[model samples]
Target: MWDNIGSPFDYIAEKYDEDFSNSLAGTLQRNRVWHFLKEEIKAQKPLHVLEINCGTGVDAIWMTEHNCEVWATDVSANMITIAKSKLRDNSAVNCHFSICSFNQLEKRFEGRKFDLIFSNFAGLNCVDENEIRKLNTAFFKLLNENGRLTMVLLGKNCLTERFYFALKNEFKNANRRYSVALAKLTKDVLQPTWYYHSLKLTKLFSSFVLIRKRPIGLFIPPSYLNLWLNKHPVITKLATWLEYTIGSLPIFADNGDHIYLSMSKKITAK
Candidate 1:
């Protein structure tokens, strides 16, 4: 179902960590994700997790380290290969990796259920609202009662991106999120991407009740700015501080480069 988007991800599989996962901006944004992940995990022991678009399994490793049983999937075979290789040394970790696309979840894991369903870093943005609704229905059935779904999504308007691009006199790049566009994964690889407003995204997942949501890079900027931010350590430090200061404010919480949104399955009487 996602062959066009999934295959292009293969082009970046090898350098994904170097280009984004390990970049300074990526680290800060991910740290904020971890904060919410920990909060969800602390209440559920012997947790069972299903991660879609796992992307080399960094978060899968963290889940296993916390003693959670994890089944991580990505659409790209190259990505799953790297993820599986990374776990070879930790034979005891209860983590599994496989190549599966978002639309294939119900068919791929028919009888399986999970305590937590996770997708990070705008992976959910690969599809449109119709696909999202299909996913919402699948999630309702795949989740255990009270199970949680957490996603990190690119927001429609990013303050940092606007200022960053505007200063460069690049209005098109600054407003790219406002329209549908193909994001460049590599010089030759481009993938369709969609940006969402927090409320718009919440409405798409109608089956789940909102748990909490917050801005991820209100002050930290987007990962693409990592190179410049890394060169200015003091400015980066200040940005991180400012993020923690106001990232959670209701007024600014939904307007960042990315938004962390969590929701819970509603248990209805049979």
Candidate 2:
């Protein structure tokens, strides 16, 4: 079954609080996201920021609290509505919301260049590399000189790959039960739209200079394992601690599903 035919983002927004925003996995992973963003985000001069596929307002609210004048958007109206409701209490003059698709950013913002352009999680994965490249060009056009472009995406290979493979019944249809569980219980993320190697991504955005290449899920178990890990919170904590100890280490980190890829506009395009 195709994932995009329905309003997937809206479906997610409907359950964002239960599924992610407040769960143990969601709480832990979001800590990683905001911690990393704080270092890169600048709050000077009413800087403009654009969040693509800004699901359910989690990051949008966080940015507002941190002093960024955020112009948040999502393709799904449902998501935008829910996210806006979440922000009703905050009076951040800089925070705004809209509905716009990734391919048509200019329609929503005419001649507005942002100080920062960002997308979180697998939002960039909604389309394949062709879409990523196209968005990169758009990011180039919409950014101020020396602007930063950062995104967190799921890499092609991870423990999730094994899970997806089992669903595909690559090991013969004997694994149908596991596949059915993944399809019904979780987000139906089995149909992969975008997952790429770091080197390939570097080339895809070679126009921009990659400032940092590192892994995010190195020590953390993927979200799908949340249930199993729930029984062993201390052990999970220890395992994640061990994982963090090795986080700075090489190739192993890259193998995880989610990685943070950051870059800066290094050249003036002709």
**Highest TM-score scorer:** 1
Give the clashing pairs for model 1: none
Q: lDDT tens digits, residues 120-238, model 1?
A: 99899888989999999999899999799999999998999999999999999989998878999988889899889989878999998988988999999898888899899999999
lDDT of 2 by residue, 1-270 (tens): 223434556555677678766777667666766766887785555567888888787887888777677888888777787778876556346678888889889666768888788788777766767877887788888888867888887765564445656776785433332221222323464433556667778888867888776666665666766776688899779756765666545465356557777888868658
Model 1 stretches with alpha carbons more than 4 Å out: 1-6, 88-92
Error of 1 at 109 (Å): 1.3
- Ten-residue region with minimum lDDT total, candidate 2: 176-185
In model 2, what lDDT does residue 97 have? 85
Error of 1 at 49 (Å): 0.3
